[model samples]
Target: MRTLSPFHYIVFSPVLFLDKKQNSYYKKINNSVGNDAGSFAPLSFYNNQPAALPVPWDTMLQKGRDSVLARATNNSMGINNEYYNAHIKGKNGRIKAVDFEHNTELKDFRMLMKLIRAYEVDAYFVMQPLNPHYYTNLKDLNPVIDEVRKEIKGGRGERAYDCADFFVTDTARYDKALLTDVMHFSEYGWHLVNRAVMNHYALK
Candidate 1:
């Protein structure tokens, strides 16, 4: 087992990992998109631009309360079938029925687990909070996470935390007050996740 330290701990969400081939595809689409506006490839909804300042409290609250924002965010991350289709296989507003043998992300994830074990690195795989109404199912992601746990020396328990389920335990957690878009979290939401991690590790 590895001890937790600044360099030893690697916390990440599996949903965001893209393989090398995917990167190449993104670049190709990006280049082609400029030449043709009606290109079939999914356009990137993620904004790489830096924020001018911290998000206001009112804006944070609006994330969950505003139907337009909620629909747009959910559609962009979920139903739009842009980026998700390339990496995952699912349909009808869902993206979590992962096929272990075919998923490149899971393959890379397993490789990452092997590296972590070889290097004795402590890591945590998180499933971030989702909108209750969102079609993506976090629980469907358990198979890969569970598979990787057996590879790590002591990977279960503190190593993974499904914040999506945590939010369900407390209604306050999923409320609009902690929302900052559907996929991202507000400051309070992050604080809750941090506290959960600390508690999982028995850290005071």
Candidate 2:
């Protein structure tokens, strides 16, 4: 559930988390830059559903914000600038925040930059394209994501966009129409996702 080194945190990613000690998992992604590969398959939106399993983020964020606020109030209380400063220099330095709303279950390039700048651990992020409807609804997520990116880049820098078939908007097709579950995607949908991942990273 938790690791002692690197940072004390959690990451729910669509990609595989590698095995290693001192953040090898984080650095392994750098391999993607070599050629351009992708994930084995598109992570099914079905993965986002609640099958008595880990709660989905969008759902959990909305459902638990109040509780999180309450808990923060109980613990952190007010801004202890002194305490915050110390943690930022020490504990926070070891943190790596990874988001999973995009195609590969990671944040956009901009968010990647911000997270990298905020801490000292190995940092990376991937942007997964969403279906038209969900992408339109969740597009606003880009702003927050960009904010994180800005934090990492500091001034400005270039970013790479995913070239995979992330959006499954062809309603004419019978396969996609089956994914009407609202949150999770169907099997065919994930196929395209996996394809895109492999293409992007140039994976074998």
Candidate 3:
């Protein structure tokens, strides 16, 4: 599973191994811009500002949700926009259910936990909520989530929040208006997620 990439060694090797004296390339780039300005600000002149729009941001978001809802209602359970359309489709164009087994081999998750512990970083993990429109049953998802929750409980203690049922539990948020597609959420769903995060990490 070790995929090699030349970009990692070529880009990050100089910064990791060489000091300021040896690596002047980064230092020169850093010093090129003033204290108040960004180094790459000049390079991004064309795409710096947001395009002028007719409607307000809130209206734009509502329009986006409306579009998604229209598409979801017109299509078959939003499968046309869903990424699992081709992957999960079986004979007679019926969506097949998958069986998930408990897996404890979370090597990357352990490595990440070690890194956060070493750096003394306050990290929080959120198991993003799923749209029931895509997955009506949680029987298959439970085992995988159980394993992940076990790892997080053993590693990060209470720093993880399982919001996998956030949308499904509430019938109000379980609509296509809250979802951009089958997998991803819309602005409204993200706002709910933001509230959940704020509530979980609120100052004591």
Candidate 4:
């Protein structure tokens, strides 16, 4: 229900963001979306240094992306060992595959569903744009997202009562080269997302 990203929004549109700041487009969405609507986590990708907050969102999502990357790099050598069955601390300190990287914290997508259920959300969507293409991309990660949805859905008992009832979608399946990194989209990526969002909203 929530997305944590290290991208800075300003990199995308200074004029739009500045206009949003003045007109409060984000605030309007925030006010309309209730607890059921879920939230965006600390989107540091939109701000930094002085690190002002991005508009229309509350709560930081994940730790700094750099910090996660650094930790993962340290474990890169260990990855080969795990692949070879020479695992270091296999069962002892297993980080879930839910994470984007080893250093990334395990975000319980199920827990998010629980909150959305509590809020009585009718529809839910989570958007995770490509981070680093070398790390993971939407086209290849659909199955993992599906698994997370199943786990978050829980069972059809009381737990099911806590799941988002109507619908939930995670849309990240875009092309690989669409991003230079998290925030700056490649020209094609930008056009793709632009068309996608417009189509989503029937904008043209």
Candidate 5:
């Protein structure tokens, strides 16, 4: 089997900076599963396989496994259906506003950039858009965004794309149709993001 190593190009998003807690949780899940789990669990299933799976059976099994794993991890992290549902409904109860000046996440982000540069990798950091409804202090976030841009440029010497800026000068920022929830973009919003990225890179 091929081991997963660092790649040539990496696209990071503000989601990394925003949800720092998720990183620790992912580590916990990895530790809980242990190194032998993947090898041993699949071995048992391999010996009992039928000639062929029924139509959609493999897909269903994969989905079921994923759902169960996700649920287990979320439960371990103290996230329940109510919390998830509130986030989906554009609630900001758990969303932490970025503290651009003194946020510790920036230190980690800068370290990441340094590591990526050491490997001579082309790295792109994307500042994702947030649902306007989710933040009552939208005006306060502008400085935070500016600080983020400055920090990335100072540390990586590479300009990061602030996808949120594309909407700032337009009426689109207020359009709820552009977002699926508190932090995710809808299809049209993603189309705009793709266009913006292509244009920035001068891609044909």
Candidate 6:
């Protein structure tokens, strides 16, 4: 991984390493977000020129959040359809067969953890909730997760929280209301994640 700035905590999802194409696509998205930060800001015109004013940070953030939520809801069906096609009905549906065992993305993720450790940041890898249709053998993915946890722990002996297994323990019984798309969690789903994290860390 790339050089990382110091942070108190770093939370990420393993879904980021699912595939090369998707990984590259997300990197581009991250770059685009960085480039578009000005657009996300509440801007105003000063003498026919665009300028960022002293907008309330919370208000600007809420505006951006609302915009994204609106877009996501508006495109939910299409997004879910695409996920189904790619992960369930298409040739790539067999995710277990995908070369994630030794993927470059995994290497990058490990490097990221090492960098985080160098900064003494608390690193947490949240396992994303998979759609019930695509939910498969968790045991198969444990090796990768375990490696990540072990590397990050490195003598500190902290463990990565098993949120994925917690949510999917019942197998084939995911709550549809918790999902906007096949893979993307809805607000309620995020609430559950928040509670789980809080509980795990014994946060107030």
lDDT of 1 at 61: 38
lDDT of 4: 0.35
lDDT of 4 by residue, 47-81 (tens): 44364443221111122222333333323221222
Q: Whole-model lDDT, candidate 1?
A: 0.44
Local distance difference test, each candidate: 0.44, 0.34, 0.44, 0.35, 0.44, 0.45
lDDT of 3 by residue, 62-81 (tens): 66666666554444444334
Output the number of the lDDT-best candidate.
6
Q: Encode model 5's per-residue lDDT on 116-195: one tens digit a residue.
A: 44544434455655544444444555655565566556544554433334323222446544444434455554555655
Taking the tens digit of each residue's C-alpha lDDT, what string does model 6 give over 89-136? 532122241245545556776677656555444334465554443443
Ranking by lDDT: 6, 5, 1, 3, 4, 2
Per-candidate TM-scores read 0.39, 0.29, 0.43, 0.30, 0.43, 0.43
Error of 6 at 195 (Å): 2.9
Which regions of candidate 5 fall more than 4 Å away from where they truly are? Answer: 1-11, 14-95, 98-102, 117-120, 155-173, 202-204
Q: Tell me the TM-score of model 6.
A: 0.43
User: Whole-model lDDT for model 6 versus the true structure?
Assistant: 0.45
What candidate 2 gets wrong by more than 4 Å, as runs, is: 1-113, 116-155, 158-175, 178-180
The true-versus-predicted C-alpha distance at residue 75 of model 4, in Å, is 26
Q: Which stretches of candidate 4 lie over 4 Å from their true place?
A: 1-108, 122-133, 136-146, 151-174, 182-184, 201-204
Question: How many clashes (backbone atoms < 3 Å, residues ≥3 apart in a chain or on different chains) does model 6 have?
Answer: 0
1-204, model 2: which lDDT tens digit per residue? 131211111121324322232344334554555733343222332334454543244454343333333322212222123433533222311112234453242334435444434444232333333223222233334444454334433564433222332323232322322122222333433444454554454443
